[model samples]
Target: MGTGNTNWKKDFDKAVALHKKAINGDKQAAQKAYETLKNIKFQVNNHSLVEAYFGSSSALIARDSTDLTDKTNYAKRGMKALDQAIKLDGNNVEIRMLRGNVAYRLPEVYFKRTKTAIEDFQYLIKAFEGNNRDISKEQYYEILLKLGASYKTVGNSQRAEETWNKLLSLNNSKYKTLVEKAKSTGGE
Candidate 1:
């Protein structure tokens, strides 16, 4: 979260790397990514995605939060930023992906965000049909995976099976084992 770097993309990518680290249990990385993304949001011309990352960074912070009130507040703040990002650019691939994934991770009973995750994943799937160039194969795979899980979460096992089945044709050798596991385990 250094201010020495003037380039927004570099700062954003660094924060993204920190986010990845945070996901792998590096708790301090989450706070750094949050601050970095927040500052980079003001540095960029495209506010939607930067805002989306800012929001996702907040969710990452929420994951590491120990206090109940802080957790809820950060999660809510992140959701609001995500909603604003989507409103700014509903079809944006990155924004939808971030928001949807974050929503999916939050507790459904408390936040009731699974439905929102479903909607965003559904949008991402449809968007992929129009242009695969914008959505990487990994993203496409993740979208299908999460979409299927979201379907199952809402009690629609049939669609979940259908979605998981789609991953087999992905043809990516790197995820071969993971794909099989997702299909076999109902995306659990």
Candidate 2:
């Protein structure tokens, strides 16, 4: 096999071992493994490793369960690491999707203070620019759903509705599900 396949197998094996160790309560080993995987240079797609980083960051945030104030910083660090992954391989759909997810989960108050959440969401929009039309459509609807959800969380009901409508226009499977969900919930 070529280097691409070889490196991916190595990363996959390490990721599995790390997750097993984490499940067995080896927190330090788990963290070290996740960091190593995140830093691994792979010719194959590295989206899974990047997502593993997000999972580890989320785990770290959860460990500090008492500190809501610090959770935002945890999210910020995850965003930076995800951004680095995106810089390395910007075309990976999963990386862009995970970046969108990080933006969507951020608290509204913190987002208002620094606007980082909005910037992150905008980055998702930019990530799809100039892709093939079919892929573009799929990503466009995903962004609309995420943006609509974020705006609703932030109390921008009007913008959320607009985004929902744009998503409905695509008539894709997921967007259709979302449109019906919105209608049932009175357009949130």
Candidate 3:
């Protein structure tokens, strides 16, 4: 447990550093934090905490990366971290949500691992189902949108169309056209 605590402290320090860097307009700090967090894969049994850190660090890194190629690689690393966090804490809605989020952002052509994304979305939906009143429809809809996009990217036109229709049923008109277009274009 001493090592676990040490890892936690390290993560906390990195978070503090990231905040300081962002406050000082250090764009690279965020990216650095992501790499640092990735390296800290300290095997936390507490899934929620691990996932929370993973999501926060990944977001910072992904948001800071200027090059598309770099962003994709960083995002992929973030996804792996989040996935492991989820395995340790599969019951956390937030963890599953982060997984869906990372999966959604991965490149379609090169990182066309739609199956992984689909599993994450499935987990998110299952977790969400048990917490409907506690979670906002907007948040759930966002996952659905990303899941649909993932399906489209993997050439599952039917699943994408069905998911898009489900989103529309939830009154998410904002992404309806885009989803429909993707469905029609067979995800390009």
Candidate 4:
């Protein structure tokens, strides 16, 4: 058996940083980072590819293009990249979350992918419930909350209430107020 090194930590971290910057509203930084990252032809593994695709998608969304056609093209490119990433790593919670986040934000006339986002959140919940060691407590909580919100977005108030109640049972004091507010609004 041959042992080959396949460490993607550095590239993955850099991509994550860029994605965070994009999420934080620094479109220029994200565009630059995405361009730089995209030029790197080799990925050590599926995880690296997932991050690269996600970063690229974020950059596309962040890029400032005055023309509506240009903006739509960028979004289409981003969605395709994300879809490729998902195909490569279907069970990766982070990848699913990233796609779901983007899909959830897109307008109904454009993408109407809220159902996909809901499915991703539900998948994450099932993975967590299955005692998947890869998930952290924080990730679990975030997924739960997002799941509830997604339910509400689709007008499933009953399901949303049920999901929120499950989150409340987690007993995390820090999120009590937020959960209470969400519950009070019937998961709105």
Candidate 5:
């Protein structure tokens, strides 16, 4: 379905921008990004990146939906896409990030996504050890912060403490205030 000689690269960039806006709370951007990413997915020959963006857009739609049915349905669709994306390219950092972020937010009782979140975050932490360029230092910082919370959510307090300690050791100046508060309150 790569018809009309679609400039998929441009579409991908545009949709990614829209997805970022959607993440920042723009409903219209979410809708447009979802549609564009969904369309680009079918048009692209390779699915790894396309599917990741589509999955992220699906999560956005789920987050913005008012109806519980729509919300759950979209979330399920997004999870499937994320699984497929990871299967296509397990080492892709952005895919892992998207999936981890979505899984971390899902209700564990209903979605059973906590383990997936943990796995993805762990993979990301390992990925950070090398020449990984798919994500940024800030993103890694956020990942460390959330990884600790996620461990706590699953009752793994020791792992949580280790993760938070790792984050604290980073001593990122941009997150100084947050780091100070976290230090005082143990990032709970």
Candidate 6:
């Protein structure tokens, strides 16, 4: 697919905004967003298209449905979409974060993929370490927090502590308290 569209960025941003709203529990809005994303006829770059699929999948998962099977199916679809996104852009921090967050939240009964989350976070950590300037300060802090949490989830308390310590050293004003709290609690 050609990546020539100048408006793709705007469309991608709009879809992401709707996806965020859906994630925050707006079922109707999520459905609408999913529809809009799905209906986009223009060919976008793989990265943008992957994000659109991810957004659609998120909306599906966020949609209210009473059936357990339906919920599971939706989640599975989302995971598949995320997997595709990751495959499309293996080093994309945003794609990795999306999969990491989804895997981290999955229940043990539903194929808990916490290890996958840890792997993704670690990849991000390594990438950031190699080139800190590749991402913004806010993004760096967010990755550190997620990496720490993922480490803790995988029972690597020492690594988690180390990661949290690094986060504290960053002195991110917005998340300093959060990092301190997590650190104080040993990344519980």
In model 6, which residue pairs have backbone atoms overlapping below 3 Å?
A: none
Question: Per-residue lDDT for 1-188 in model 3, tens only?
Answer: 22445656666576657745743557677656655554555544444545556565665566577888777766666666676776777767766665666566666576665677788787776667877554577777877877777887887768877887888887656777766776676653
Off by over 4 Å in 1: 1-10, 40-46, 169-187
What's the best-to-worst order under lDDT?
A: 5, 1, 6, 4, 3, 2
Candidate with best lDDT: 5
Superposed by TM-score, candidate 1 places the C-alpha of residue 5 at a distance from the truth, in angstroms, of 13
Show model 5 residue runs off by greater than 4 Å: 1-6, 173-188
Candidate 1, residue 108: lDDT: 80
lDDT of 4 by residue, 65-87 (tens): 67777677776666666677777
Determine the backbone clash count of candidate 5.
0
Question: 5-98, model 5: which lDDT tens digit per residue?
Answer: 5588798899999999999999999999999988887777557888888888898899999999999999999999999999999988889999
Q: Rate the local accuracy (lDDT) of all candidates.
A: 0.83, 0.59, 0.66, 0.67, 0.84, 0.68
How far is 130's C-alpha from truth in model 3 (Å)? 3.0
**lDDT by residue (tens digit), candidate 6, 74-151:** 677767777777777777777776787677666534656778777887777787778856666677787788778767
Find the candidate with the highest TM-score and give its number. Answer: 5
Per-prediction CA RMSD (Å): 4.1, 6.9, 4.9, 4.2, 2.8, 3.8
Candidate 5, residue 124: how far the Cα is off, in Å = 1.2
Worst 10 residues of 2 by lDDT: 111-120
**Ranking of all candidate structures by their TM-score, best first:** 5, 1, 4, 6, 3, 2
The reply for model 2, stretches above 4 Å from the true place, is 1-9, 12-73, 83-94, 110-129, 133-140, 172-177, 180-188
Candidate with more favorable, higher TM-score: 2 or 4: 4
Q: State the displacement of the C-alpha of residue 141, model 5, in Å, after optimal TM-score superposition.
A: 1.1
Candidate 6, lDDT over the whole model: 0.68
